[model samples]
Target: MADTQFSLVPKVINGGIAGIVGVTCVFPIDLVKTRLQNQQPGPNGQLMYKNFRDCLVQTFKKEKFFGMYRGSGVNLLLITPEKAIKLVGNDFFRYHLKQEGKKLSLTREMIAGSSAGACQIIVTTPMELLKIQLQDAGRTATVEGSKAAAVKPPKISATSIAMQLIKEKGITGIYKGCAATALRDITFSAIYFPLFAHLNSLGKRKEGSHEAVFYVSFISGLAAGCVASFSVNPLDVVKTRLQTLTKGSSDKTYTSWMHCFRSTLKHEGVLAFFKGAGCRIMVIAPLFGIAQTVYYVGIAEYILGIKK
Candidate 1:
């Protein structure tokens, strides 16, 4: 790896921009993924959604175009800090872990990535908890309605959800799935950062720059994002299930990640672990692709005249 002046301001700006762009483009797919993961099989093995496409269609049919972005308010608002912490934290760790004339080993890379992942959980857990509730609310409301009088689900907002959670469970209420979120994010970063770095390194560099060409970085991010997203999907499923606290009485409850993993496997079969794997890959690939492209483009650096 090459050295650049370590500056937080530009990196933070770049990360926030990357997150906003990526999330804007892919939030709908992510919403679908959450619904799929949260959906439980009905009595007699029926599922609300046949698959990702069905889920998308149903959401569009019921909620229309903007409905797909149901929980985007909180996600978009918090993702700036969430991504800023993850990306910038990774860079901070990697820069510190690098030794003079020593190659950055894979283990160290993973450690750096994991550290970044851990650091972001402070923001990620609460953001995801609120986002999941809002995202899955529409689907669950419809399901509950089918068993009773048909009525429109009440409009819910992120602020309302946060306030309710805080009032009920105090501040920690919003971090209902912190442990599961940490597991998913740490594992994802451990896999993604090292792989992205290695693949990005193989690409042709700019004339005198250590950075790979923008397209190469984007492709590297996409590929790594897909693999990492797929690998941690089971954890993501578990996390989503854990965070969604509004399940009906019949829904199975899990006390921990292992318990959820085992229960889901036993009840829904092994495939349950990957309920939204396809949507996850779709959402993550382009998300990281655009994010990496933007990050490497140094928009903040350009605006601030900061030399890398």
Candidate 2:
């Protein structure tokens, strides 16, 4: 029989490990997605990247291999807790939301997932703000350098960014795109968790066991991630633009998410909202594939002599 008891410590540890592994493997792709989403048309309607391929090629040519990971330090550090809250928080809610001896209703499952998404934004907002800054800093520097003399911009780090935001705008300064983040994450999780659980349930299970096979979980996570990532790409774009502090003089400032949405729709059109969608799928698929597999595999359980 499966272990019905919830063990907080093991779940937290497993979530942290899953997060670290997933972020490390996919951070480069995520950086590309951020850069793509942040790219706005120039005064003459010229864009920095024609497409994802162009963006990847340009980044490789200009920034090299290491540059692909520009903002990864902060992402890796904070993603641990952000993902921990998201994954384990979902499980925690699902465990409680279900009535004893009854399957959880799909609505309750969505609520549980949404609650997890809400819980994670406390860390996600600041983490994303700093990450977008660092990831897009190179693009900003590159554009400026091309127009001006070929001088490299001074290096900036996550610690410095946090300190400056704290000093200049207080602690709340770091939560620049919180509303957008919440919309994207909550929607994504609501869709993703239910879909992943459903798909995983349909897959092959271990002999005489309730759990799906590891590969099944991975595939379920990947499929769910791709669908959810694509579905929320518009919100992701808005969030990226809102959080970006290194806007050119021509860039428009928005008062809120609605303002940003309307302005972007008016200026850039609907297709603009899908910026970096492909890259986001690329990043998220492997991320949650690896993350869910590791999480379900119960590494902590093995270590601590707990069975699930």
The ten-residue window of minimal lDDT in model 2 covers 145-154
Q: In lDDT terms, which candidate is top?
A: 1
Expressed as tens digits, the lDDT of each residue in 1-308 for candidate 1 is 56656889999999999999999999999999999998887777778888988989888878888889989999999999999998899999999999888999999999999999999999999999989988888777887777333334459888998999999999999998899999999999999999999999999998888888999999999999999999999999999999987784457788988899999998889998999999999999999999989998999999999776
Which portions of model 1 miss their true places by more than 4 Å? 147-151
CA lDDT of each candidate? 0.91, 0.88
lDDT string for model 2 (1-308, tens) is: 32578789989989999999999999888888988888777788867778888778777766788888888889889988998999999999998888877888999999999999999999999999998888888677766666434334459988998899899999989988899999999999999999999999999999888999999999999999999999999999999999998876556788899999999999989998998999999999999999999999999989999767
Evaluated at residue 180, the lDDT of candidate 2 is 94
